[model samples]
Target: MPVLIPTLVFRPVSTQLLVTDGVRSVGENIRDALRTHQDTKTLGCHVHEPIRPYWPEDAAAQSDRIFTGRYNGRRFALNVTGGTTLMALGARRAAAEHNVPLLYVDTDNGVIITLAPDGSVTGEREITVSVPTSTYLAAHSATVSAREPWGKAIERRESWLKPFLEAATVLGQAGGGSERLLDVIRPVCSGGAAGPAELPEVTTAEESLANRLQEFGMIEVARRGGSLQVQPKGDERIRQFLTGHWLELYVYRACLTSGLFDDVCLSVDIRRRTESGTVVNECDVLTTLRGRLAVISCKTARLDHKDENKGAVYELDSLLQAELMGLYARKVLVTNRLALRPPLRNRAGLSQIECIWGPHLPDVAQRIQSCLLPGRR
Candidate 1:
């Protein structure tokens, strides 16, 4: 038999365009994209630190930060920013030199330049940008608009919502949010394609809820007019949406510890560049339990807990961060499935590792609450 070997290339210059007409537009767009792409399994952005190889100060050295992941099997990177003229010019220049697309989100709408391989801009394409109404803007424009403290709270929430919006869009699309539900009703309803009937009746609250559902990869807009119609993508979307709340509970449950130790906050992956010019991505959870900094490296069944040689389980890596946490701190690994080796588990200098099953969140939460209480053991 003839032998055929598949070739793979690890490094190739590939990029995608991301832009929104304004802050709110960008937020909405990102939210939509995130929901749409969440269900393809392991759907999350892979961030990298800025790379400046032989870059002069005068030259463009910094690449705009991007969030890259898969959507419908197509790869895209979104570059979201508040409007700035200098950044706009830089984006255009970068697109031409590197052969990437550039999207500009402005006050009114978004402008994108589709580039050729040689880096010449194609025809300017404009897309509708979602923005808050003028009345809403006027109410929020002043520093002390309406209630003195309310504006700040609103701003903070908006800041958080922007990123979430993008995540929702990607997940929503992947999980078949609308399509899943639509399939259930398509046969029974009067119309052969009875997708619209599957959606809830249109209302302000309903629309907002729909948007939120879209973020979770549960439902999507099938048709929009005076009354917007929604439909499910598939069975997976329905299952994912129905179980999302439970999944969140499962995450909380998995992280919870037993009897003693309080103050638990769900940790997420955060990436930053080191001074040594190396880009590093960290996967850990950090919390202060009674002024003691506890840095935990969490793992799940879905996650691979091994390095190259596989002689030593990878839990030892968590200790390196403990050294960085200093003497008044601790390091631990939280897992529902994987168990560590004896020597590593029996170390006197290290804290006892903790594990919680998929069903044990309440116990973990109680333990965390106990840890945080004053004068509690």
Candidate 2:
């Protein structure tokens, strides 16, 4: 077989177009996508920027220049996988005029289709591509400032934290019980304790649960005047095991356990500079699979009906902002709530956002697996 040299000649649409359209032009996004594929060796990357990116003549002229100047007398193919309609038209015209092979990617189906010089479909095949962790970060204009492999971290401490997580689940399900429980424990954990007289009355089951916590050395208990005085050990381990950090850690670990993602980063702080100034966003969990990106936002707060609507809007906006960094990036929201309101669900659906609530928390890995599956997007 003759050696095939792949030169990715693409166009970068104007920044104004990207901002107005809420996504990077197809050409820019496809370049990143192609760079991630292991089988694709890019010999050269030529970016054609037209004065009027929306004009076919300008786009076509740029394409012709690249084809004749750099790709001339070379065994190459023209991939018109992205860009505006006029941009595509320009590239198609150049390909037909030059008798170069034309190619297109069915992104929705994970297939690469080949077209004859005349623009007829000649053949196609499915392909699996994955982005490296470093490449993923670079694509988002982010860096790995710190690393916390939540899955491995939790697995190392699961023996002790398992019971704590179970207890937390019980308290969490008691509606206001979790907050009350935390209130009772915070003072004790801080090296202070309420007198028995100042303690709240507890049911037999609540008392038993307290005893379990005491046995774990997470708290101390004193009984006086038929009331239970509690003090927390205030250990870092105890705090992390009991607080909302537990849920966030659980979600991260779940994603790691799925064995689906090529890369996973927990607690990523992404900073981007704009004309005005620099802006920063904290991502709870970031993962990449099959060359696609997914940003998972984990929440433990219970929002009321009105707050739920607001929360949905806020999350959607955040996801959209993240999308600007990585076009085709998936948006996911993970929460402990039973379910998002119908309106919230509808809004998420329209935005291509995935909402995972309490019941689905444990199945996050499977959900992510499904999201990364070919043609699922």
Candidate 3:
């Protein structure tokens, strides 16, 4: 928890890094990342020339040189939190030689701690700076290729989308084969893309749900005795919403209105270049809170503990690892199910991922706030 640097007027040694790198490519990426960080450009940060050193001895020498050779007489502080042990040792030696202050970010409490020349706590200040999703991903060595904004059109439709979600809750609890029907209907709505479809046989629950959806203008349905044929409304976005995107929009709205998150993005596509090849990931809903990444995966479809939902469970768990959002990320899997099956809940629990169901989604923001600020009520 020693990597978050907030840009504050009164702080330890002003915010910036004299980046150290064993690999020049990685060092350049770091510099680029900081240069493009949300606040770095506007608020300003001091970016020193990169120090390339492979060995501890070299690390100490070059790090010292960065301060002494060029910027003599200017006050300096050494930050040793992010780099390797060898680098930290080198940095410590350099700090001692120059008699400069040392500092590291305290990620756990979202604070920065500065050490005096004696290594005692000189000052610690809370970090109130916010980082966007792109900056967060870049810190983990990923780049955002593309992302979809939460549109104003969607905002205008929130009131219109409410009834269908309410009906979703009621029909979700209905007995009979409604879940299977929903699985079919969603694809049909997506596949048709505002076109007509002859739906498969639906039960009383499904028929009721479909009819309610039709009344909500989600689709157009004509009843022919026992069979049902459907057509989506003209709007493609609305069709997408009817096909499980509603959950994502609802969750996004919850976070936005909550005013707790630093940044929230929907449908974010990320790319990370690796030695093997280019790696890619897409987040349904991505956010940063309390100096930690939080990824929320939304599901309007039914989920049960049995291997049926195992892929979804593991995919969400995977996002919490270093390959993606990093181990420090807060992971949450959200579902329209009023309550998930016990085993599924336990599976998510093993990864410490919080699951929010339809009934409790009204408080999703509160739940996120609680996770980010666990000490608070």
Best by lDDT: 3
Off by over 4 Å in 3: 4-26, 42-56, 145-216, 219-236, 374-377
Q: What is the clash tally of candidate 1?
A: 58
- Which runs in model 1 stand beyond 4 Å of their true positions? 1-281, 302-316, 336-351, 368-377
After TM-score superposition, what is the CA distance of residue 167 in candidate 3 from its true location, in Å? 11
Candidate 2 local lDDT, 262-325, one digit each (tens): 7776666666545577666667777877556777877665554767656755764664564455
Q: After superposition, how far is residue 241 of candidate 2 from its true place, in Å?
A: 4.3
**Best TM-score goes to which candidate?**
3
> Listing every candidate in turn, what is its Cα RMSD in Å to the true structure after a full C-alpha superposition?
24.9, 7.2, 5.7
Each candidate's TM vs. the true structure?
0.28, 0.69, 0.74
For all candidates in order, the CA lDDT equals 0.34, 0.58, 0.65
lDDT of 1 by residue, 61-114 (tens): 343233212332343322323324454455545444554453332212223334
Tens digits of lDDT, candidate 3, 248-273: 76677678767999887766667877
